[model samples]
Target: MSGTILDRILEKKKDEVRKLKEQFDAGNESKFQKIPFYDSFIHADKMNIIAEVKRASPSKGNINLDVNPAKQAKHYEASGANAISVLTDEPFFKGTLADLKAVRDVVGLPILCKDFIIDPIQIDAAKQAGANVILLIAAALDDEKLKSLYEYAYRQDLEVLLEVHNEEEMERALVLNPSVIGVNNRNLKTFEVDLGVTERLLSRFGKNHDRIFISESGIKTAKDVERVQKAGAKAILVGETLMLADDIQLTMNQLKVRLR
Candidate 1:
């Protein structure tokens, strides 16, 4: 609690990882069939939406604490979401693995376990809880750990969404030759949001046809979607906006702009 927001969150994850290791079992089976997350963007002409099931955040406090994860996920799929991102972190995000399981039980779209994943046990736990994709932030792990986790998730048959914030992290992310890379607009350590983060990074790194580029966070309108899509993002990971929307379907439809 005394450290930076991300520092505190990672510290909490360490404790959670310890608890997960004690309960880890190799016999666990995934309840839902895995959907190819990266493929959804490849075949799409419209900007894909990775709708997030989030209750709260350390920066925003409580966004929608009473949200039903399963119901929200089903709504997303109906509204043309390409994938679902469930925040499985508890200390800061107020989300649990149970929320992910509930969402998985209802939707066939790829499910992304959006958490501060730092260990193999967390990946195993996410897989057991029915995650088709797991997020690996470049800012959180070193090159060695990042490559290890990226390979480990692939071996577990889970897709990795490698997240980067700036030029430095993007450089590190490219070394893994990730299939899906997301540029997070929010700085985890300071908790400041900026849409330019995605544009700047993509402009510098340029775009790739083989890999999917996603702009995550601070997206709220069609124009915002257009901006990132023009920056070479095939997909957008939206959380707070959808969680706080009065009309979830309409909001999602608006965000699903045609690819530029």
Candidate 2:
């Protein structure tokens, strides 16, 4: 079973890497020297919501590829998001470097380039594409690889958000000493979700880790936001729930209210 899991992950990564190269070669990367966004996010007053921009997911398929990246980013900024996350994977996600660059240009908020993020090629691509942050998933990377990638991100002036789903993976991410630690409520193995995952891990983090703890996934309504914030999550990453809202800004404002 473990072998099967490894094989599937490897295949997905191979495809993701191939797609990343295509985005790099597209010639629409950010023209600027990359702004310092980490400091901006660190100063936000409330839960640092990282609004994501993407076309689709492999699980859902085709989620607003036609949505204008800059327009969406403006809405996110107006709605009080601390950061933005752009999906640059073109295969399963149908996203590109243009999407990330678009968000970077239009918004003053810190931006996170969200993808599988397997290799250094993709890391450089992210920097060139104008991402201020990068995600490191513990399930997809070994300890050494995580350390290498996290260090690379930091060297480029990018903050690292290490994501994990379980106690064991949390242990792995803890070793990397990432700037931010995110506990994803969704289980990669079964796609199951429970906010308790964050609550459970809070015990292990203790009170003096200095890591900004974030909770991701299954966050739907203002009530969900309230519950997780009370559970000790400093921030939350919401995707589909906000994406599906009739008014994106209204939805974000509702969540912000709950955070207070």
Candidate 3:
């Protein structure tokens, strides 16, 4: 990706997050209070494929840009998804917290308010936007900020899923000790994907970690899901693959049944 694209994407996200915070503080957002992500697979009787409702990305532009959240969310619920992940960042992803609220009103499942969370204000905004979980990227924060944010999310009864891309990021996530630790297959710097990233992390520390382990990114088929399932991850976070499908519900149901 060009530096221009990356810069523009991040700048747009910053402005969008700022407005989300403002709107949240104004008391005009949905606050759905149910922690379905904790025992998600048990509740659904299948491994999770957290379906994401997103439009664009820095890597791939204008995907599902005109999709309706409320309608799509109903499909996801019907398809046997344990939880829904809404990309709340607007600049690059063409997403918003408003979309999250719309999904919440249309579905009963938990929603993970996916964004570049950097402050407590954003956490408050996520809660207001009806999120049961929040993702904290390991590379985006230091030790002190990570601990503080994790504790804050825990205090608010939100499931914190710390995303780690490599060994050092995994070490940082371990320090925060979130309820869930996600092994992302995409490299942050270059945006290249390799499912081997999950394997390497699981090989070294998967057995030792006390929290729930989730494999994220680079999963495009049932075989990929099965590959990570044996590595001890009961859940996976998939976005682009699911979003671009003709029938997202069918796709999610297939993933859940195959993984089960």
Candidate 4:
């Protein structure tokens, strides 16, 4: 699996981070601070939506290829989305930090810079781009790097959504005592989606699990949202469905009806 699509993506990320460090000065980081991501979900009172702005993906290419991230973010905010998730990977996802900045200039909602973050440079990049939250995939980093990156983001005043794809990864994520834990139902290697993956992992945690549980990926309808919430997820990160909807707000309402 060393030459797998995920592996190649990670290799490219490392090279990009190195080049970014050469060009970016850490002292020149953005002065724009942000609210805590956990607070957004807490105040939402229902299953919060982390509406995603993505143009393409490795699994399903060219989704909304002509996306206007700023415009889409405005629509998501108008539709009562609790937060926004901006894809920042350029090669596979056709996303850039520019997209995050564009949305940041327009919306007050918390924005998550979704990417395969392996190095601290990417964390700094996310901060400089006005991202309030950063995604740290457990499968992508070792225990030491995961802890280091988690603390690095915190030091930069950015919140983290530690993503775990399985029980083993969840165990590693819990070691850091993260404030938020997202169960990603999509397999990174095979790109196979199974919504039950979130439910199964969430069930392992009792009511006392203090971390905010977010179900990510494979969520399609109100019923899907309802299913995850029933399984104990406090939030859901939705992408393609809302992105492809003819009426974004209407689709949001449809998915949120379960909460009401």
Looking at model 4, the pairs that clash are: none
Q: Which one is best on TM-score?
A: 1
Spell out the clash pairs found in candidate 2.
none
Could you tally the backbone clashes for each prediction?
Answer: 0, 0, 0, 0
lDDT of 4 by residue, 99-154 (tens): 99999999999999999999988998899999999999998999999999999999
Q: Write one digit per residue (lDDT tens) for candidate 3, span 104-162.
A: 88888878998878788888888877899998877767888888988998887788889
**Alpha-carbon RMSD, each predicted model:** 1.2, 2.9, 2.8, 1.4
* Candidates arranged by TM-score, highest first: 1, 4, 3, 2
Task: Give stretches of model 4 more than 4 Å off.
Answer: 257-260
Tens digits of per-residue lDDT, candidate 1, 9-97, equal: 88878999888888888687766677898877788989989999999998889999999999999998998889999999998899999
Residues 46-110 of candidate 2: C-alpha lDDT, one tens digit per residue: 66787888678755678786889899888888988878888876766788877998887888777
Evaluation by TM-score, superior candidate among 1 and 4: 1
TM-score of decoy 4: 0.96
Which of the numbered candidates is closest to the native, going by highest lDDT? 1
Query: Judged by lDDT relative to the true structure, which candidate is superior, 2 or 4?
Result: 4
TM-score of each: 0.97, 0.87, 0.89, 0.96
Instruction: Looking at model 4, report the run of 10 residues with the lowest lDDT sum.
Output: 202-211
